[model samples]
Target: MTIRTTHVGSLPRSQEVVDFIFARERGEDYDADGFDAAMARAVAETVRKQVEAGVDIVSDGETSKISYATYVKDRYTGFGGDSPRNAPADLKLFPSFLKRIADSGGTPQYARPMCIGEVRSKGQGELEKDISNLKTAMAEHGRQRGFMNAASPGVISLFLQNDYYRTREAYLAALADAMKAEYETIVASGLDLQLDCPDLALSRHMLFSELSDAEFVKIAASHVEALNHALSGIPAEKVRIHICWGNYEGPHVCDIPMAQMFDTLMSAKARYVLFETSNPRHGHEWTVFRDRKADIPDDKILVPGVVDTTTNFVEHPELIAQRLSRFAGIVGSDRVIAGSDCGFGTFAGFGAVDPDIAYAKLKAMAEGAAMLS
Candidate 1:
């Protein structure tokens, strides 16, 4: 398998459609078919562009969802009443310098569950239908080698703020069972599945601050267990788990060190570990691999970010090649896949760089891979 990787988080959207969905929440005038068609076109176009640029693996540009993780809350069966809310002031992960620069703009929120709703998980049938749509769109546009991204249960449970459950364990179990259905869908689709697990690291900043480090590790382990349970029959080769710090143009000083969470992460039943390794804050942290590699099983692959997503400047191909070479040297080229530090558009309404610039970055990455080869 090739080691190149790429991303197109959220494509440029017409202002009218954005307003209709966000401002009106799919009001009466909104046409679902038209919306789906537009999204499919955008996804196909983006994947086509990446494939042409030599991205070995591709995504549908995450075009259908408003926000990556928040989209699941709408599809999920549980949660009643309380809407998503902003992260508390103290828990805000961005540093003071960034806050001042961002003008203290309100960050995205998670939907709080006031009441436990029935497990409205996506079964095999729903999975087939959606996967069919994406695959068909790809085929129609002559695109190939694409994957789907699913939000991790930890992310869903944490961001949604399930305060209704009597115990944290019970809340996690409920979310685990519900999310398993979605996992099943991804497995059955026959396409590659990437679990979006930014929560594994970012949760330390957004969800739990009161707990000791030891306690936090325990909580993180449960998330891994749930994923392993859902992935029981699936071959690890078909699945990959992606972990990152918050994807924004902010100071990530509060981000958890990868070493602190490597144990729980390696325990996940996935063949590939997609992790943040680019960006100024996390770049040198690759040394964590020297100490933590013992915990990582040999069968697993490492897809380290070779380019930083929060910046608009294009990385020199030589720099991208060097990053890939370093990871390959540490873990072997066969086990390494070059990736981005985070998604280009983590938040729907906000973006640090233009979508076209994001593509140029991927193109640079592809060129670098060729140079290294």
Candidate 2:
């Protein structure tokens, strides 16, 4: 069997699609139905490209969602108005730099959604187009296997910024229960469910920066509980639990380590674990397999990143192979899947890697994976 390769989620969007999405977010006048049609075409093309690039597994490029987590605001209930994105501690330490970037208008910001009422999915046909478009893309692409990524309950709380729930647990439970429908539908449709869960670590600094480690872990454990409850109906084998530190180019001083969350990650009802093991900050974390080998459940799969997405330089195929080989050496090739450190364009219109380079990186990853198979 070949060593499979896939990305975290969002790939870059076409300029036309980007314009329509940005216009919608800005409350500017745009044709809503037309925008959806354009997005569908984009998704179809993206899936086709993924196949052409030799990706063993593919995604919709998250064409319909604005950002991974914040898109939940429109699809779910209780979200209203805006919440300011509190500066992460790392950025706070570089206020002058942050000010310059903001002044330059180089950064695009999404208004954080506020939780004002109660949380429940609107059953609002949000995923209808997403699911249909992906399924259609599958048939057209002659897909091997694919996973559709969605924000986990914890990540929704992390990005949307809660304002109304009496306690964090209450908010998490409501969010989890509300998100259960999305999770169930994907699995029932025979697509792998990848739960984007940066809250387990990245949010410890980005969202809950003020909390102590012990305090932060209390929240993390609660997130795990809510996630398991959300996954109650789906078989673990079909689930992919994706966690990571912030994907941006940051100092990362405040980010938590992988060793800290291994137990909680292993406890999740997921057979595949996807996370960063290529970027400089967390790259060394591949050692976690060696340090905790016996602790990992035998059935679990490790989708360690073999390519770094935050940079524009295309990784040499041999370098990519080396990264994949490391993980395979430890976990055995059968359990290793090559992946990017994180999504190429994690947020809408917020691509760091050049669009063309992103596909090159993916192609290189596929070639690298072939080395092992």
Candidate 3:
């Protein structure tokens, strides 16, 4: 069987899209029709670019979102005020590096609304628009397979703090119930639903940094339970979960090992698991899978990132092939797919990889997948 290629959702947004998103975030009035038109064009262009780069599967580049985790604020009610920013423990240990990033205007500034009341969906208008835009673009390019990214309930709880819910478990349950509609909607549209669950991994060193690894694993298990509930109605084959440490370029020394949370991650209802394997910090963890092969469900497919997303360096196709081959050797080649470490654009205005170079890397990834095939 041939190897396949895809990427972590967010692609670099054009300046026009960025302006509109920020304006709405700031509560500034903007033309509704004009925003819709802009998003349509952006989605079409992004999908076209992915096809040209030889990617087998693609996304809408998450062009309409400010950021993956925070966009839920716009879709759900009961969120207001700002959540306090929690710096990653690894980044906090190096204040000078953090200062350099901030001084250079690299840190993204966007609204992080808190949960202040009972959670409820505003409507599915925005989600429907996203689905329409992606499907239209994919049709134009003759692409049959694509996935849409949605923020996981756990990640939503991590970014948008709970002020109204009495306890963390209560907050997670509320989130799971509220987000169920969106999860089912995507699957109903005949598209793969990708649950971006950074909270499964990234939160270990950010939100629950003070807890021991065992304690954090228990918390992660609770998160998985909530996620599974949200996915109850959908087929596991129609869903995939993405796990990653923070996307920023920093000392990721504090990231929890995959071994510690592997069991919890597998507990999600998603049959496919997408996670980082290309970045230096977590690159060596492939051995974790090799050592615990018996634990992975037979139905599960592994999408290991074959390209690094944080650097401008365009990895050679041969290096990418080697990375893919390593994972293929552990699991059968049919069980693996090539992906990127995180995302080219995590936030609208904030990204480390250049737009042009990001595409170049994806092109390289496609070439690498071809080598494996």
Misplaced by over 4 Å in model 1 are 8-20, 23-28, 83-106, 109-115, 122-130, 140-144
Alpha-carbon RMSD, each predicted model: 2.9, 1.5, 0.8
lDDT of 3 by residue, 1-373 (tens): 6799999899999999999999999899999999999999999999999999998889999999999999999999999999999989998999999899889998899999899999899999999999999999999998999999998989999999999999989999999999999999999998899999889889998999889999999999999999999999799999989999989889999999999979988888987789898889999999999999999999888998888889999999999999888878978999898999888989998899999999999999999989987
Give the TM-score ranking, best first: 3, 2, 1
lDDT of 2 at 253: 76
Best by TM-score: 3
* Candidate 1: clashing pairs of residues: 84-110
Give me the runs in candidate 2 sitting further than 4 Å from their true place. Answer: none
Q: Which stretches of candidate 3 lie above 4 Å from their native place?
A: none
lDDT of 3: 0.92
What C-alpha lDDT do the candidate models reach, one value each?
0.70, 0.86, 0.92
Q: What's the distance in Å from true for residue 111, model 3?
A: 0.5
Clash count, candidate 2: 0
* lDDT of candidate 3 at residue 282, scale 0 to 100: 93
Candidate 1 lDDT score at position 335: 83
Model 3, C-alpha of 307: deviation from truth (Å) = 0.8
User: What local lDDT score does residue 231 receive in model 1, on the 0 to 100 scale?
Assistant: 76
Higher-TM-score candidate among 1 and 3?
3
lDDT of 3 at 369: 89
